[model samples]
Target chain A: MSDAKFHLYYWPGLPGRGEFVRLVLEEAGADWVDVGLLPESQGGGARAMMEALGQGAVPAYAPPVLKVGDLEIAQAPNICSYLGERFGLVPPDEAARLHARQFQLTVADVVAEAHDTHHPIAVMKTYEEQKEPAKAHAEVFRTQRIPKYLGYFERVLKANTRGGGRYLIGSDFSYPELGLFQIVEGLLYAFPNAMRRIASQVPGVMALRERIAERPRIAAYKSSKRAQPFNPKGIFRHYAELDEPNAMK
Target chain B: MSDAKFHLYYWPGLPGRGEFVRLVLEEAGADWVDVGLLPESQGGGARAMMEALGQGAVPAYAPPVLKVGDLEIAQAPNICSYLGERFGLVPPDEAARLHARQFQLTVADVVAEAHDTHHPIAVMKTYEEQKEPAKAHAEVFRTQRIPKYLGYFERVLKANTRGGGRYLIGSDFSYPELGLFQIVEGLLYAFPNAMRRIASQVPGVMALRERIAERPRIAAYKSSKRAQPFNPKGIFRHYAELDEPNAMK
Candidate 1:
């Protein structure tokens, strides 16, 4: 393996998309730094993160950017795929690698939808400013999207006879599996009532989630200070009204 | 180059995300077929596309899937990147390839946001049902997001001294440039007033749009019987109220 120290720039307080990149890094036991979490004096914080975004030859439009030596990459799924390939977290075959990236991109789609549940009308507006539309959007999300995505993943898990239904790609656990684990965790945190109600229909997905959480590196990271809790400021925000499962009926 | 015939599956009568892949295929002069547009008696239509999505070992969650021999790839950007690598539409350097994918993913983000401007509350609901929320969302998208994203791309164009500001990647034109062309076309179709109002701020992006359009293959495809007009059905839908330039003021 190439010995390269990696630098990650993302918002510090929230797990957000950065956590997706962090899972791969932690699982690979790779050398990396959460540059955004450091003090401003050491070239960290939001200002420094913003500067880092504009400094790269190929500048990132947003955060969750991965910088290794002179190479800078952005977009969470892209970063995860790059890191996955680098640390042997991706599959060996070309087709499987493409499938892994496809799965990660699908997970990203779900994540974006989840973020929209609380800010349906505008990203810049507060939840209070768009609470009515948020309620309407959250209802569809909780009722339709949640089950659809979970069911699709459950189907994928069951169809993966090559992995004995244990993984998304091959016999070995890969980055997309980590991504699945995170999405499930975030959904549970953001919409507990709805997710729990829908969980029975996706046993394969839930079982995989349990197995991922039990992975040694993942377990250690979750219990560590590095793991940030989901909050209103982040993508998957919890609002009691939005999580109500009565909408499903 | 491999002489594999590509089969594209997407919703017929709408360019949607499938056009991004089409631009690359057309530009490469690759042998491909839009299977969704074929007659149902010959194994085409929504039913066939839906079945195709579930039949592959690596099933796609949604369409705009590219099937080649035994390989079935989904997600527009993933398919474009794969095809780019296969047909020499991507940069030769590894770093440049990653950057092109980054730019493509960014374009996808904007496209998603643009879709939200017309369907903010629920994707299942019609725009008429959520017209008020869509109006609120579109205002922010037009006034804030349009300038932000276009301005960012303008900077990318300006900073790319390597390509002499003609492309987003290395000296050669690549798949991401095609993606940028599609997005600009989409925004103009969806929000003509806002796009025209903001045009003066992003000369490089607008100029790049012109160059991409004049590409012989792309020009031929755009004027051919295959090019589907943007309507209210697709991601970028035109609504007079949403396109009001007064929002920018």
Candidate 2:
């Protein structure tokens, strides 16, 4: 039932944008392939990516674009929502589904802000060139924005009616765990102090991350070459300068 | 049916973020009032804003949040989708509804990018201070991103099987138009030279904008004081330095 014809086109070296999709398919136990991680698959990578983007349609510029047969969707949340539907991970009700997507978009927004913590001024400029602004902005984000988002997500999780599964769908294996864990892990990696102090309050979310990390597929993938080691090149790059010691707390 | 219990809270000045929700409600012909518009209504502005933001929600960071009796929702697209559902602007099917949401989110991505054209470096900095960076980024966005987003949207509209409507929903006013046209209008105001050329090729989208502009609620809103005239302080600021006449196609 999981033999999916999905091709996720992302860069080979970075646990980049596409990792969210990869982690999800792994959790769903779906049959999908990483299009570019293997050298021999790079051409297919470009094809899957460009087609999903559409000819003369608009270059996605960045990777982690996904293809479900003929559709070439680019945005991460867009891909996640599509897969959620095809994989039966979305809520049964329309409003619930909208909320799921809204939550996903919020997560994506958090991730983007995390990226900017490292690259604040110009996406094209080096961290050294933008260090001052990056530091100032990261301070604002970590102290003010981070807690706001985390607290809100915690509230939403508490509102979830799922009794014990600890998933966003609680009892259901959903990508919220993957997204939340990625966020937590990224924050832990990038803004350790702030995330650590505040994270203890969101026990359910933290527990879900630990739980997902123990999932067989994710655990196996984590050990494989398929999982790109987190480095400065990815969305959640660790910059010691930005993550001050007391910033997270 | 249109006159229900919808309260919209946005900045009292510029149409800004509130315009997205305003346009959708108008296009849907929903019964909603622009809260916080008068002197005595000052406090309602504060209350209307706080609640529409899904009280205690992190995303409630800004205006244009919507409040029904009890549910307060924030984020531009979230509010639009909620209204789109009640107004029949969204499709009955979950897939189509999600698709509509995907389209709406894309519009939002572009809107943010458009905003960045003027404030690429720091949100707190004056436009003049960021003028050089803004000019450079705007060049890339105008030549590259504007075409990319417009083309993607045009293709989505063209691919619509429910075709033959002057709107994204095909024959109806979907809120995407309100958002996209806002993008178009902002880009045009901000980058006249680039739009003069790009708008020519995007006839379908242009037509849709024209159609939406003709909707009585929207037309009246645009003519009334409610439609804040585009100014330098809003998301889509018009800066001469940022838009060099020589840079356009």
**i-RMS of candidate 1:** 0.8
Question: Candidate 1: which docking quality band?
Answer: high
Q: What lDDT would candidate 1 get against the real structure?
A: 0.89
lDDT for each residue of candidate 1 in A47-71, tens digit (9 for 90 to 100)? 8888888877777899989888888
- C-alpha positional error of residue A17 in candidate 2 after TM-score superposition, expressed in Å: 2.7
Superposition error at B35 for model 1 (Å):
0.2
Model 1 chain A poorest 10 in a row by lDDT: A1-10
For every candidate, what is the interface RMSD in angstroms? 0.8, 4.8
For every model shown, the clashing-pair count is 0, 8
Question: Which residue pairs does candidate 1 place in steric collision?
Answer: none
Compare the candidates by DockQ and give the number of the best one.
1
What is the Cα-based lDDT of residue A38 in candidate 1? 81
Cα-based RMSD of candidate 1:
2.7
Candidate 2 chain A least-lDDT 10 residues? A52-61
Candidate 2's displacement at residue A121, Å, is 5.0
lDDT of 2 by residue, A64-125 (tens): 66666545556677677667766777666654565566677778778877886766545666
True contacts kept of each: 0.74, 0.07
